[model samples]
Target chain A: MESKEINLPLTDKAIDGLQIGDRVEYSGILYTARDAAHKRLITLADAGNELPVALQGQVIYYVGPTPPRPGRVIGSAGPTTAMRLDPYTPRMLELGVKGIIGKGGRGPVVREAIQKHHAIYCIAVGGTGALLNRHIKNVEVVAFEDLGTEAIRRLEVDHFPAIVVNDAYGGDLLEAGKAEYRTKAPPSP
Target chain B: MREIEAGVITEAVAKLAVEATHFLPEDVEGAIRGARETEQSPLGVQIIDEILENAEIAREQMLPLCQDTGTAVVHLELGQDVHITGGFIMDAVNAGIEKGYGDGYLRKSIVAHPFGERKNTGTNTPGVIHTEIVPGDKIHIGFMPKGGGCENMSRYQNFLPGAGREAVIKFVCETVDQSGGNPCPPLVIGVGVGGTAEKAMTMAKHSLFRKIGQRSEDPEVSILEKTLLDAVNALGVGPQAVGGSTTALDVFVETYPTHITALPVAVNIQCHSARTKHTVL
Candidate 1:
């Protein structure tokens, strides 16, 4: 399958053009956040307070990387389960977050928000952290340092691999892909 | 009594912590490679390839096989005749965890409390340890670093005696279905039957320590394991739930005697990482 190379801070037009099952190699900047950071972001938004980092046109990767070993830019960094962040995703989408990179499927509301906002939900292989970390060139903690692994990070990546699971056109690769391979079980005796 | 030093246990556990995180066990690696060969979906094949590549990278570079290096779960089979010397066994294990996680650069994932505080433990210490007293003089330790994604998908139930084999199979399959791609399929399904609620759960976790493809010594349970494995794979959840024929690599069932009125079951799902290591002292 042909994989498309995409620059981060995706434009609405760029996101709209993508579809479920399309392989993508993402480059440029991607932000990192997991459940804790998501809660903080939501709380700040509800309080009508400014976020520590701007969300406009950025991609948030659901990940909490291991601490880097000596001389390494980062340690094994892979996607966490995306559904855990489902409750906080729609709001982030409303804030103009253009893309999400994580493993697993988003809930219904998050999918609908993706369609409405012309954003995309992408998945990196869940257990492939060591491989994924190689794509990251640099990392900086931008907020919530006290959260340790859950802290928000700004990452510069090169050709980071992902697959679009939910797209602006309401395409869901998880649903489509599963349907293709689903086999009927033998009748229960 | 055979005496074992605290330092010996700590050193062994420390080594296991790093080894379990960095290396994919041979059985697990073989199963994944088999899944890649049999997987029919293009997307499934692609994902398996990446997983295999990830294992290679992690092994070569001494990096963790997954970012969620997991809660350090240590299972100890202590012989009744052995005496642990120097310090408390639990303290030795925790000290080893601190050193291993810190030196290996594995993620410290444990929070201080489930509901309150939620502070990082920093050392990933106070590991969830399961100890059993058995015959003989050797101390056998099994180290399993279980990630949160798959662990969250686990389920337990207390069914009435009327709920038969079919119901148990149905519950196990449905749990895997609801889990879909979240637990990082292809997976290993561990089923614990006939025990008390907590016993069933513990057995479910312990069943994961068995080598992939190894079946229960009980012929009846062995058949049930096969049945559940087939049913789970048929769910069409596939690899990463993206679709394929290999959603589950194996199903391990461990059963114990229970009261005539009760039938308890617990299902523990393990991701493809399947990281485990063992030592006998």
Candidate 2:
């Protein structure tokens, strides 16, 4: 796998050279959703309903950021656990969502769907809410206004960062990394 | 008995909510640093670095460690000798929760109902407060704002009397391993052994307030903590489950003798942020 540095408004062709574990700095439009939004999205897809926004080749970020401070465009925004959205991910991928920005490990089903659908699971630094939000320059509630923090939001980010934990070729950085570091416990006397 | 003003309680709670959310306790900071130094995965080290950096930024900028500041769970040990004045005890705590979350700009996470029309209370008010009457002249407050990720991963298992320690160990390790990366890594494992089912779970939640890496005095349980810690880390769930050897920074176990028929255990996994504060008034 070759490592390459790429710049803004990323497209699938531009990111083709990256592999699992490769670091990438992204500067583009990022979408946000929590459990409620994901459920709503799944319902829409099942109903063959038009989505609030076209997800074609877009990156969906799993986050429910705090309310922004007085002057900031967005508050502390960070990746949330991805597994909770596992059930809805395949459908999103089928709809042309290209990448998922989140933390924690995705289930085997989601990983397999990523391989089948040419999508990628990218992990942003979890718990680094305030620092991560620094990269976000604009934030607007796109839908689900009544959900409060759980509302779907659209954010414009600059050099927002992540690592590919699961890729389009059935590779999982989580299991591979674990295999590299796990130590066997000693036998009892 | 001396009378203490409800306003004092309210003020203390308000300060505690903001402070606990905005700042990482010294012990928690130390634990994260320690994990960073000892973690084997390059990714894990990187994750810890960002977590520590996040802590610093949150404090300096007055931002929360995570967007989920969580519901304010307060445990109050009120002194029997002290009488409250000005207002009801619960009212004072609610006021504090309201002001703290409001002024701090933290997210309001609580809903009026778990089922049916879920409605946001807006103020993050009516904190889950547990009151215990104790013999003392001052009221002691312990604040633990638990995140949804970890709280959602909590487990309760009821083992038969013959199940013994191995069963407890297996149950806990499996729960953490199954949790994968979701609970946030370098998790604080809180084990409540013995007591009734509800007590065991509450003890599990309350156990999170213990200082990081601090072990119970019970020699047996102290050893159990070490064993559990080693087993959990062995899962290679590392920070954020990105995979590493230091998945759990510490494990705390609190126990009480139980009915001969019961050997209940509850495991509560806490995220690395570990927000908690202690105040005596």
Candidate 3:
């Protein structure tokens, strides 16, 4: 339930301290990467080659936004499901990525990566692409433009709203919250 | 037999496809707003508000309500006494899909193959069409744009003859609960029971086109829908399955007679953005 507006140069402590369900107003540079871009990023990091952009303390938003209408900065820019990028997230975190934003819960591998790397996973509301895009102040393609919406775009954001779903401390809001509310079938009467 | 021109049906199908994809039906919008009011979680409330805002943007910008745009699913109720002239009805439907997807700038999501050499169709055509002939002069077309996220989560199960209603209910709830926050929640659960596997699944998908909160025509099925809806919401999957009071917006069940040995059921979980439209001509 804690709320805070954040700016860049985020520390591991700053991200790891968050718990599930905390509201964040993120204002700073966040990069967009989806399935294809995440693969490319990992390859570059593995090859010991320079990344298209620095990952240290950077936030990556998993999205494949629709094309923007003429005169609009971006189109419906919501978080895609997180599990699609679960395979690549731990690698990114190890390479110094600070926060991952998307919808849906991540797998054990990703949760472990967050704890080990002190990174965070934020849940941006799904299907709110247009509303979410309004928070982007500026956007530029950093790499993989041929991936269409899946390209890596460097986005400048202001108070982009999301909930801390998973944090470095190992709090998983999706799991904990669901467990609290899951009504088990009543024992045989 | 009364003859109708292919041009007429083609135009209608195209318009229906574009309209269904471009606009979120009014009832669907209303249901989301209603869910927003009743949802208890603070995060859920914020998410609902953003969804509402997204709807406005989609309308103002004339963009597809969701980027998925979806696979074109056309359901046709053809009159027994009528004959189509100039072209095949299926041809008209495919042409309509192409025109709609091309002209609307929607993402053509259909693939030529599943599993290997998966390639985009370029134009969203060769729709999943179902036709039923009935005693009438007019044609009734239902256009449902089925998105991938929810479609991927759809399930079909064949229950033992003795599994009964409780098993069916458990299956639906378990499936949706497992899909928490993934199918993009505040979902409408469409349950199809008592048919063969494929038939059951199709019925479940078509059941999504039912008006939100409307009861099934069969009283037993209506009761089942209510029971399932209550049980699913009780799961607290909530908006975006992030936890709240409103996991499923409604549950609509469609059933048909089945073989003596099987009690087949299919659950087609759809997100809040259930895009569908219908026209009679």
**Clashing pairs for predicted structure model 2, backbone only:** none
- Docking class for model 3 is acceptable
DockQ for all models, in order? Answer: 0.65, 0.53, 0.41
Q: What's model 2's TM-score? A: 0.95
Q: Which regions of candidate 1 fall more than 4 Å away from where they truly are? A: A185-189
Positional deviation of A66 in candidate 1, in angstroms? 0.4
TM-score to native of every candidate shown:
0.98, 0.95, 0.92
Residues A1-189 of candidate 3 have per-residue lDDT tens digits of: 557878875776677567778888898899999877888889988998998889899999987766666787776677877887888888898888989898888899899888888888888887766567678888899898876777899999999998888887898888777766666552231
> Local error of candidate 1 at A146, Å?
1.5
Number of the predicted model whose DockQ against the real structure is largest? 1
Off by over 4 Å in 2: A1-10, A45-49, A185-189
lDDT of 2 at B66: 87
Tell me the lDDT of model 3 at B16. Answer: 87
Candidate with the larger TM-score of 1 and 2: 1
Off by over 4 Å in 3: A1-3, A47-49, A183-189
Cα deviation at B158, candidate 2, in Å, is 0.8
Clashing pairs in 3: A77-A129
Query: What clash pairs does model 1 have?
Result: none
